[model samples]
Target: MSINWDDLKVALAIVRHGTLSAAARALGTTQPTVSRRLDALERSLQAKLFDREAGGLRPTALVLALVGGLEQMDAGAFSIQRQVAARDTGLSGEILVTSLDWLGDDVIAPMLARFGAAHPGVQIELINGTRVFNLARGEADLAFRFGSFEQENLIERRVGEVAYALYASTEYLQQHGTPDVGDGFEGHRLVYLDRAAGEVPHEAWLPALARHARIVLRSNGLRAHMAAVRDGVAMAVLPCLLADREPRLRRVALPHPAPVRWVRVGFHSDMRDTPRIRALVDHVVGEFELLGACLNPKQ
Candidate 1:
C-alpha cells in the first residue's frame, strides 16, 4: 500500500519540531490529530520512527536514514501541486515574500502595489524582518537577502547593489561639525547598528571609520536608527534608499565612497518550476531593475 502523503507530512513535522505539540503548532492542527497521524504512519509502515526521551523525540536510525529522502520528496510533491494549480487557475494564488525591513517597506511594498493592479487575483504577503527566514523548511515563498544563499538547493540572482552614506540631522551637523577621515571623529557622537558591529557590511564599515567616536545610540531596528539620526542623537551610516527621501537627514560627504553591497533575490530550487513562484520572482527582479536608479541616485 502506498503511504499517505498527509501522514508522511505529519511524521516529518513531528521529527523536525521534536514534539507533537510543536508539530501541531507548525501544521495549524491539534495535538491529537498530529499524534493520530503519526500513529497511523508507523502502523502502516510497521516501523518505529521515533523513540521518546528526555531530550525530545529522537528518530530511530531507520527514520533518520529515510528522512532526508522523504523531505526532498515532500518538497517536490508540494511544488508539483502548486504547478498544477497554477496551470489550472492561471497563476492565481497567495505568495509569501520575506525581506529586510527597510527594503520591504521602501522598495518591495510599492512594487507589489503596482504588481497587484496588474495581477488582481494574486494575493501577496510580505514578511519584513532582520532575521533570515528558512526557505528550505518552507518558511517563506521567496526572500530578498543582502548576501548569498547558504543552501545549494536555492536559486539566487543579484537584484541590485545598495550603497551606504553618512547621514545626520541638520542640527547635529551644525552643532558637532562634520569630521573627515583624518580628524578621527573624536568629538562627535555616532549611532550604530546594535547586536554586533559585524552583522552588516555597512554597520561594520561605519565603526571602523570612527573607532574613537562615541557610540551614543545603538539599535537593531532600521526605523529606530533612522529616528535617532533624525532626532540629532547621532550620525549614522544610512542606506541610500532610506536616507535619500528623509528631509530631516542630510548626506555628509565622505572622503571616499562607502562599499556597495549586493542584494539578491532567492527561492528554493524545488519551487522554481511552479508558475506562480516564477512569476513573483520575475516581477521582483524586474521591479528592482526599474527602481535601481531611484534607489541610489546621488545628491
Candidate 2:
C-alpha cells in the first residue's frame, strides 16, 4: 500500500500543533478538511493514530512510531524541492517578499522594479505590514527588516543601518527657533509612535525625548508621524533614509545623536542555493551596498 505524502503532512501538522483547528490553520485549510483527512489516513493505515484528550489530541503509539520517519521524509522532501528550484537556471517562479510598510513605497518598490525588469518571468508578491511574516512557516521567501534577526537556522545578513533623527518642518524650525540642548525640549511639540503600538525596543530613544517635550500627537506609522511634522503640528523622530530627502524637513542638532538600528535581509538556509532566492538576495545586497552611505550616514 502506498502512503500519500499530503495525508502524512496533515498528520504531522496535527502532531505538531495538537489540534485539528491548529493543524488546519498551519496547513492553510479548514478544520473539517483536517478531520476528514485524518480519518481517511487512519482508515487506510487500519490503526488509531491519536487519542482525543482534554488538553488536545494525543498521538497514539502508532502515530508516535511514524513521527521520526515522517519528519525525516519531510526534510528530505524539502531538500529535494530546493534542489529542483536550484536547478531551474531559467529562474522562473513566484518569490514572496515581506517588508515593512514604510519601505514598501519608496525604498523596496524601486529596487524590486529593477529586479523585476531583469527577471521578467519571475513574479513577486510583496507583503507589506507591521507584522513579521513567519519564514519558518513558508509565509515569505525573503524579508527586508529593521533591528536584529531572531529566527534561528536562517541565512541572515546585515544590509545596512537606519538612523533615526529628530526632524521638523523648516517653517516650524524657523518659528520655534530650534530648541537648544540645554532647554531639553520643554517648549517643543513632539510627534512620536504610540507606546501602545508595543514598539518598546524601537522606541527606547523616545522616553528621554518625551520626558521634557510635550507629546502633541502619537501615531502608529512613520508616514503619519512625518506628515504631522511637515504640517508644522510637531517635531518627530524619523528614519533618515525617508526624511532626509524631504526638503520641507530639517534635522535637529541634539546634544546626543539619534539611535541607529541595523537593517537585515533573511531567508531559510535551505533556500540559500535556490536560484531565484539567491538572485534576489544578491540583488538586495547590491542595492544596499549602493545606498549604504545614505542609510548609515554617520558610519
Candidate 3:
C-alpha cells in the first residue's frame, strides 16, 4: 500500500515526541492537524502504531518494526533531494561533519582546509564535541567516530587507529621524577579526563601507576587536560596523537596505555555514492594515510 510522505512524517514525529502536541510543535502545525494526519496514516496502514497509556502514546511493536523501514525511506528521499541540489548547483552545498573536539582540531581541521581549498564552492561545517552525534537522526551528514559501530544500513570504514600514552610537563617530570609500577604515585597529583574519572577503564588503568595516587584535577576536555599538564597542574594520560605534537610535554611511562582504538568514518549507505560525500571520504582516507605515523606512532 502506498503511504503519503506527509502522513508518515507526522506519524513518525508523534512517535518520537510521545504526544500529539509536542509533535505539532516540532512540525510547526496545530495539534489537531498532527492528530488528523496520524489517524489517516493508521487508517491507510490498517494497523495501530501507538497505544494510549497513562504516561503517553507508546509505540507498539508494529511501529518499532516499521520505523526502521520508514527511516530508510526518509534517508532515501533526502539523498534524492541532495543529489538534485548538487546537480543543479554543481557541488556547491554545505556538508555537516561531526567528530570529537580534539580529533577535529588535530586531524580533521587540516584535511578540511585541503578539502576546502580543492572544493572552494563546497562549504564544510564542523561540529566538534564529546557527545556522539546521531547520524540516523540526521544530526550530521558525516561522522568521524572512534571505536566500533554496529548500526545497520550504514557505511563504516576504519580510517585509522589511535594510541594513548601517559604524559606530563617537563617541569613536573623534573620535580616529581618518572613514575613506574612501584613508584609512590601518592607523592604526585594526577590529572584526568573528567568524563573518564571513576570509569572502570580509567580506574584500572590510572591506579596501575601507584596504589595511592590522588586525582587532583579533572577536565571533560582532552585539550584542557593536556593544557593542565603543560601548565604543571598534574600529569595525565593522553592520546599520543596529541601528546607527541606538544613541545612542552614528555612521555612519562607506559603505566596503562589503553588498547589502540579504531577511527571510523561513517555515512548512510545511500549517501556513499554521492560525489561530494565520496570525495570527502577519499580525501580523509588519504590524509589519514599520510599522517598515520603521527596519529598511530610505533611506540
Candidate 1 C-alpha error for residue 184, in Å: 0.6
CA lDDT scores, all candidates in order: 0.80, 0.80, 0.77
Tell me, by lDDT, which candidate is best: 2
How many steric clashes between backbone atoms does each model show? Answer: 0, 0, 1
31-97, model 2: which lDDT tens digit per residue? 9999999998998888899998888899998899889999998777765665555465667788888
Ranking by lDDT: 2, 1, 3
Model 3 lDDT, residue 157, Cα? 90
- Estimate the TM-score of every prediction: 0.83, 0.80, 0.72
Please report, as a residue range, the 10-residue window in candidate 1 with the lowest summed lDDT.
81-90
Candidate 1 residue lDDT tens string, 1-299: 77998998888888889998999998889999998998898999999999988876888998888899889988787667544443534577777889887888887788777777788888888988877877776677789878788965788988777788888999998898887667668888887777764577776666666877898877877788888899998888888877878888898876665657788888877677777777777787787677676456564
Candidate 3: C-alpha lDDT: 0.77
Instruction: Judging by TM-score, tell me the better candidate of 2 and 3.
Output: 2
Candidate 3 ranges with C-alpha deviation above 4 Å: 1-8, 19-93, 134-138, 195-204, 255-259, 296-299
